[model samples]
Target chain A: MAHEHDPPLDPVFKSSLRELKWIIVIWLVHFVWVLGYCSTYGYLTPETPLITVIGMPSWVFWGVFVPWIAATLVSSWFALTQIEDHALPDASPLPEKSEADEKGGADHE
Target chain B: MNEGSTAALLTFAGYTISVFALAILSNRVGKGKDFVGEYFLGSRSFGVWAFALTFAATNASGGSFTGFPALIYTHGWTLALWIAAYMVMPLVSMALIGKRMNQIARKTNALTIPEVLRARFESPAVGLVATSLLIFFMFFYLLAQFKAGGIILSTLFADEPLFQSAVSFVSQTTVNIPWVNQAEPDYLVCLIIFAAAVIIYVVYGGFRAVVWTDVMQGIVMFVGVILMLGMALWQVGGLDNATRKLEQMIPPEHGSAILSTGTVVATDQTFAKGTWLFDTGKVFRLGELAIIREGQSSTVPVKILKITTPFEVEGLNAKRISGQIPDPGLTVRVTDPKPYKYGAGQTGNYVRNPGPDSGNDVGFLAIGTAISFFIFWPFAATGQPSNMVRLLSFKDTRTLRYSIVTVAIYYSIIYFALIIIFCCARVLMPGMEIAPDQTMPAFAAQLTRDAGIPWLAGLLVAAPFAAVMSSVDSFLLVVSSAVVRDIYQQHVDRQAPEKMIKILSYSVTVIVGVLAVLCVLNPPQYLQDLIVFATGGLAACFLIPMVLSLYWPRMTANATIAAMLGGTGMHLGLTCWGYIADKEFRAYSFLGVNPFIWDLIGSLVIALIVIAVGPKPNRDLVLKFFHDTTSDGS
Candidate 1:
């Protein structure tokens, strides 16, 4: 538990935040690709020949299913290989941040 | 009783019996565990398989099996895209918080979401506010689950011998009182039975019992849903045929079914006596035609009696399909009905059919709505109090990894499989104009009957029933814990004895269950809508505060309070406004976003801004949540 006054932030904790940023970025890009490219909504009207991939709609095959399969794989990778299982090192005092850094409070920076 | 009803009733009974046995078994096995911890959090002792299955079952409600499929049935191929967001739901929900949640939970011994928030911020009011909001929305969710159970039971046995005999017994034995008939709403009997079964097992077993039951039900639902999916494909020959069958291009008259009985039982869509039913290959649902009288306008209110049946029709590639329900059944009952046709196509270019929410012609609105929905529902699953309860009980980080894989695989199969099943259903059972929520049971019935194994239908019916029960039991526990652990024990009586706490926990669970059942007694038709709003409401309320509290160390108690109460009030206030102002508020979007998106966006923005500019929190509060140690480093 944190006391009234604590030591400087741990480097491991800061890196985890950095890792969180990268993960969110990767997933957000994937989300856009699935929605904008895979799904043919608003572009293909009802009159268009329903293109099929592996006997399913092209949008569903390429968009929803393919993208999700990738997502699941990536999620597994993150959970297994990427994330640090051990808790961050105890909050021992470290080199002090500059005045500007302290005011900014963006520790992950 | 007939074979179908008997099979259904027996399957349901078997499921209930298993639940009771599991509850008893868990209670017996829990000798060494602390009562409060064991009853509420399963002593924080769940393995990978247990964690994965319980998490999945708790999250996937009856809505997934029933209401979701109906949307697929109503909308054509586009429904798949509408739900594509789910592919990332498990990942987003578990990954960001997976490690932190498990570590911090053990560190603080927080039993509930409210407890976690309270300890993290060192503010009792945060706990109170969060608990109040969870209880408020979760009650509606619980009510929807109970009502969904009732609907599934009633619909599955509506024409079955067992249901008929039970109704007959009641109607014959009881006197007919004015206004309140003994056998009216016929769904009430099924509702009561379902409620009692759920309450008994949930109260008896507690968290361990719930998780154990979830594992069984999850497996049953997984296999049962897959079976229905396979049967649906087989009924339509293959996925290629299923898609082409729905893709057949026909004239506007093709939209209306050409009913041909000896006499036209329904006049709305019936054409001549000899020609084929409109020669339209595109059929999405079963058609219901009102039998009109002389000088009676189609617009005026009148009695509507339905007679629908699915029969073979030749479509593209000269294929025979049975899903086009063409002929009306009650021609003999109508008075002098003649073959007639009117009100052909409403949309001339409705070619590749769109799902209910997704429009055929993708536009800005469609893309925006899709984006909003993708974010909304997935966040709901991740941020739900019910799901959080399971996450808190996980034994270790390895369990989290296993849960992620399981959840991803599980949702991928179930969501995609449902789309296939209902799409095939469109080919095999179109013109079914019942309540949209009946899509699961209706499709399950056709899929099983077509497979020549009526018994499988019994188990398939149990799948959705299990789906609802899993969600209900979990939510019930969360609400009860919020009251007993977060509010009563924390605030009202901090010195409460352990014995008293155990009793209170059990009692609170019972009281909440009974109240939810009472809410379902006079069930409304739009319970699905209520469930959606409740889910969205939960996401709006908790997603912002919970995430920020963990990640943003600067988030003060004031910000947490603002986010919880303000977010909830914004959603509830807007929803009530929509209900009062426009009856069909779901159809209207705020600015360009759906109500859920708008609510979530508003709450999240407020939380972010407030944390950036709000009052500085106590040093201990931030240190406790963010730091691992203090000056006395040992």
Candidate 2:
């Protein structure tokens, strides 16, 4: 707990873990929501005429295409904003300025 | 050789030689490095496009190019729904594992999935078990790819000079052995040639070569599918007209009345359950094979004006349409999936039974089956070790983020485009072949003939051929690496020299490639079945432990071992029992779903319960595992 020369560190790992859970939950919700629409909304009966999209059934369009757009947006948004790139906990403890880059990983600036 | 066939063969040769050149160049580039990292992981330096295309190409496999098209051709439009899960697949799989796996691999220099798991869990046993399971399922998966390669080559080149000569030479010189199918001269020759090409390129260039070739293959795959789609639709007139003609093939008043398809034509012929409703318009003369394509554009009947002949129902005449029959102005408007068969001499029509076995023999005619299919793929996708290899090989999180988006978009366009093209193929090539697996090549061949562009046939064959190679190369590496790196190096000889590892890597790649081909010489079933069985086993074994270990800190070594071994055992037991009990090919049905689901869910439950009841895991170990790579303390 007492490594010197680095700014006093507040561990964000626990909160990040919490944030990860929330992200997972949001992803799951989107999955369930899409499946729900597919099974519930698009599962049409014979008497009902299916609207065609791109020359396919309306239900299929909603089931696959709509969620495709939504998923693209949702995933990209999550990747951009929610995923904060952090250094892994330094397996080696060193002065803040001289944190060792194990194997000098090329990713480290 | 015909000029067109000669041209096509030359084009194929050029593509293969170019791929070999890339591999040779990459081998030079990859010289002087640790064999394990340089060979298997490419020293973990792939930029955005390399990573994205390789990842996509690896997953696209022969199934994507061949089997999927077959399903769409045979079963109809529901394939659009079946493969829809792919749109969210990259998000489900990549978003969860990509950044974390890359971070951890860089931190620990973990070169393989087992290496990653072993490091993450701090348990050699976990690594061993995972590696064993990977090798096992990868065999089945790899064999399927080989089978696909053989099938593609045989179908596309059946009329070629080399193939015909080889077949004649083999049959004339050889006697039929009890276990061997001496009849399949073309399949054996293609399998050997395909296997040789893949192993040589992969063994020489290692991961770098694989990735470079994957880039080429990925582009070929996209172009091939798009051009095939355009050609198929063009041959059938247009999308609007194609779907229109396809609708007419249906007997009006079943349940599939989607796409503004046709209402039934008032027929002068009403044959009962004995046979199909033939020539609903009563226009074709005797001895003419008339095809009844379902209509999507209007109420008028669209029938193919050709027929071969089937006198099977001559004695069972129920009732020919007398002068005045009601139009039944109401057309069935729902597009229900069903398997139908009609051709020369076959008087039967594809029927839709809303009761039981609705939508022909495609049992997934109901809502639940559709949803279940959607769920299986994404779930199985996450558990594949080859995919994990891709996840761990990315250069950075930024690369990962971009690849995820790119793959999602790529799959969406490619899979949907395939559905349209294959659906249209059903119209252009009516009753083309009985076996669904033959449809893609059949369609491609038909396209080449009709368009009079023989070189296009080379491109079409190359697409699936590329998919198979992309999948097989990665799998060969994964299987061989598990033996060399995880087993021999990690456990057998920690101090094994780099030279020995390099030699072992290359030789093991060849041996594994050779073994996969031999197993399929007596292949029990179709390539699709083999792929599914292997995928199920792999997912059942790895999905829970791998995904859970990533996020959950409390996961203990005991849980990992139990999940790894126990899950694999459970899948084996269930599949074995299912196989022994059922006469049908879909032998692994645990509670009406593919055994993968039950096995995965069952395995996860077992794992969680084991963790719940076991001793409190070492908090320090847990912290150490999670701490170093994922978060910064400051």
TM-score, every prediction: 0.83, 0.80
Best by TM-score: 1
**Residue-wise C-alpha lDDT for candidate 1, range B435-472, written one tens digit per residue:** 55677777777677767777777899889989988988
Q: Say which docking band candidate 1 falls in.
A: incorrect
Evaluating just chain A, the predictions reach TM-scores of 0.62, 0.58
Model 2: per-residue Cα lDDT over B1-634, one tens digit each: 7655665577678878988999999888888765678799887788889998999999888888777887676556656666766767877777666666666566566788887777665567677788888888788888888888888877767768976898777656545555446437677777877888899999989999999999999999999888888888778777766554444443212222221124433443221111223333321111122222343233323222222222211211122344222222222222342223221121112111111222344333455565666677777787888898998777766777788778877787788889888878866654433355777777777798789886678788788888988998999989988999888876777777788988888889999988888887666656566577788778778878877776676676668777877677777777678768874434466666767777877788888888888765654455554554233542
The recovered share of true contacts, given per candidate in order, is 0.25, 0.14
Task: For each candidate in the order shown, give its overall lDDT on alpha carbons.
Answer: 0.68, 0.67
Error of 2 at B532 (Å): 1.5
Poorest lDDT segment (10 consecutive residues) of candidate 1 chain B:
B339-348
- Candidate 2: C-alpha RMSD after superposition: 10.8
Candidate 1, residue B574: the lDDT equals: 78
